[model samples]
Target: MNFLSQDKSSSRPNKAIIILSLWVFAILLLGFTFRTSLDEMITVWINVEEYSHGFFIPVITVYFLWLRRHELKFIEEFKHSLPGLVIVFIGLILLILGGLATLKTVEQYAFIITLTGMFTIAFGLPGLRVGAIPLLFLIFMVPFPQFILNNLSSKLQLISSWLGVEFIRACNIMVYLEGNVIDLGIYKLQVVDACSGLRYLFPLASLSFLCAYLFKGPFWQKVLIFFSSAPLTIFMNSLRIGIIGIMVDNWGTEMAEGFLHDFEGWIIFLICMGLLFIEMWLFSRLSGRKVAFNELVLIPTEWSGDTKQGNPDIRFNKSVFLLMLLLIGAAIASHNIEGRKDLIPSRKAFLNFPLQLGKWEGRNDYLNQYYLDVLKLTDYVIINYTQPESGNHINFYSAYYQSQREGVSVHSPKSCIPGDGWQITQFGQRDFPDFKVDGNALIINRAIIQKGDSKQLVYYWFQQRGRTITNEYLVKWYLFYDSITMNRTDGSLIRLITSVKAGENIEAADQRLQAFIKDLIPVLPAYLPGKNS
Candidate 1:
């Protein structure tokens, strides 16, 4: 009887150790499975200023876990859950789909999903309840997709420029605002992508969320605290621009350049963070209440480690075996996926494109080296076509990508048009049933954009595989679908721009573009490959 009891007593710690080892193995397997995405995210942290905060997010997450360690006491037992298994399967599907699509954003999100699913599988609802915040907080490290970043940067530039102009005007300084450019008589301040405040917003938003998690206050106050980061960053960033303008007007452009300019960003971020704390204090005092910094932070009570070690009832659950197998399978599958190369289709070079098409006489134009480096297009053609009869001219441009993976893909005209000091007055898609490409009716995105007294009519569409895409989001979907089903991700952006004469209406410009498209359509197939090509 005594020998049997000793054997059973020795087995308890062995069971616990096996469970701990399996947990560690599962985590390592996840890291191996998602290594590509993790590497990509780390690269963004190192290279991209906007996402530099990615490096610290993991550390912060660990701190949050430590803060909530005492709550793990509630996790007395873990059992097999069918719902969790379903989630795990869904996560696995997403990982495969994302891999097949060659989408880093999707893969990054899959990491979060799989982690959630596995956590549930291992510990069930009780553990998830305690650890949800820390786990979800890791999302801040994943960078936004390039298209979203571009769209957001463009919008923020305009907002910052407009508000900065307002601040300058309030100071009784002469200023003119056009798109994202601020004109101050002798000085012109262009609010480039770097000045878009994303560098500040991303980090501040992450910090705000963490602060909200720790804030000991009403739920509404915590919600307000988390949501305030964006406006706070934008308003302060704009103020910094305004201050730079003021300094420039008085101290010349030197104040807005070199080390001091970079220093200003850090200063603005600190000020914004300080303001958040002040807001918290003001909220605490609003209803005749007071809370100190220490009080504001909800600290989890730490107990002696006796409960953790003293409990002999804890035993390893068998769900971990399934988790182990799933993770290993995921790792092996991802390895094969990472090795797959994009399929590049054959097409005529853009340089071989004819200069003369129908009645329009085209003169080929070449972009500067800087633009070529920035665009990263595999092949492209740009030409200004003119009709000698009416002396009317139209700008025709098409950019093609042999593989739309990584950062190389179509740049939507909507995102770039406003960056060049144009305000889009009317932007929507129109069906040109009268116009056809390969007997298929064409649907194009038409826009009326203006800069000062100058106005232009622009039409654009994405030619993906064999389909014409109008919406930017839809293009992404097709990119993924085609990459998987058709083994093709090649696409092109075809755009036509024509001036809307001072006295003429939009119809006249439309007529000009109509003529150009009629001639251009016949020429596009040779360069932009379709399914048949």
Candidate 2:
């Protein structure tokens, strides 16, 4: 017995060294493989307030692993998995594609997948099942693509605004809701991105996930706890907005901006966390087991002493070593592949674009510094054109990007128009076979949008590599395809807006836009660089 104890103590240091060596190897490989993606994620965490919680996710994941260390120690059967190797291969493909397309989001997801594959290869299915939640939790750290974020933020803004106005009305306060704005007679509150409930939703969703994982309850109850995060965040945020509206009405507009507004957000987030605890308690009662909140949610101070010993001999799997070799080769290839620069087509700038288009006379317009910064456009042209004889006017806006691989790209009007208090009454595509541009027929997205009594007709399309795309999904697909095949991600968004006359029918507005598009298409090649340009 004395010899066994001494041998166990001596081998413990060897085990620790081996584990530390594996961890170091993992970190070094991941750093080399996902260098760009990791750097971009950290930059986002520092710069973007919505994603600030990202910095804590990995720490919490490590804590979770520590909490489960005893459970993991008991399962000592190490087996190399073919499925894991397949998954690693798939991850490598995704990484290469992500590198080729310059999509950081894809690279980040691929990194997680490859790590999961490594875990599977090291300890087989049992290890993966044990650490599944922690591995999955890493997803919260990845920043969502800009397009998805914009759409989600826009929708949250509208929903929160409506609910907030409803709450204010319940209090007998004279409040009106328009799109994402709350009108309280004296002051109006616009539910912008900051107050769109995202800040609360992301952090609370993460908290709820953690709570669900820690909660000792039925599977269904855990799922319910996790899924309740979205609705709770929306409700609490709406309540906060309503409270702000009441405060603004009674006191002043000062309650809605500056430090107080931010203070309200932090307070509301804490309240959201408290509400999650209340939910867990209620779930506990529903499960027919009355448990203290502390017992139900807190981490255990010490692990159970029921761990079983397994085979003393532990060796690194050959498959894992092979995987490392593959990773090294991929890292080298990806480094070379991503270093290739985008092919920028040579063309005249928007500065040289002609203002006069046949019968239409144009006056240039400029966006403010705030908008310019937000848009991140390489070049843009905003002009109002008038037909002198009929006194008809249309606002033409075009934004061009030299490279759309970065977060800055064309924002769909489908997302932006709604945020600006416009409601779409109708939306569809229009084709013009007779009016051709650069030997290809023209197609555009036509929409009738209204705010209050005023109505406007909008015509827009994505012009990329001489292709006229009406679908936003197609634009994204082509963006990816073109980036790989043609080495160009440059594109432009063209939008034309004209008011519908008081008595004019929709057809008349369509005709006006169609006539303008005919004149505009011929001159577009000079400004919007395409295959021909």
What 10-residue stretch in candidate 2 is worst by lDDT?
Answer: 71-80
- The deviation in Å at residue 57 for candidate 1 is 1.4
lDDT of 2: 0.84
- Candidate 1 residue-wise lDDT, 307-387, digit = tens: 555433444667767777887887888889888887887889988888888888989998899888878999899999889
List of clashing residue pairs for candidate 1 = none
Backbone atom clashes (below 3 Å) for every candidate:
0, 0
Pairs clashing in candidate 2?
none
lDDT of 2 at 421: 68
Instruction: Give the Å error, residue 294, model 2.
Output: 2.4
- Candidate 1: how many backbone clashes? 0
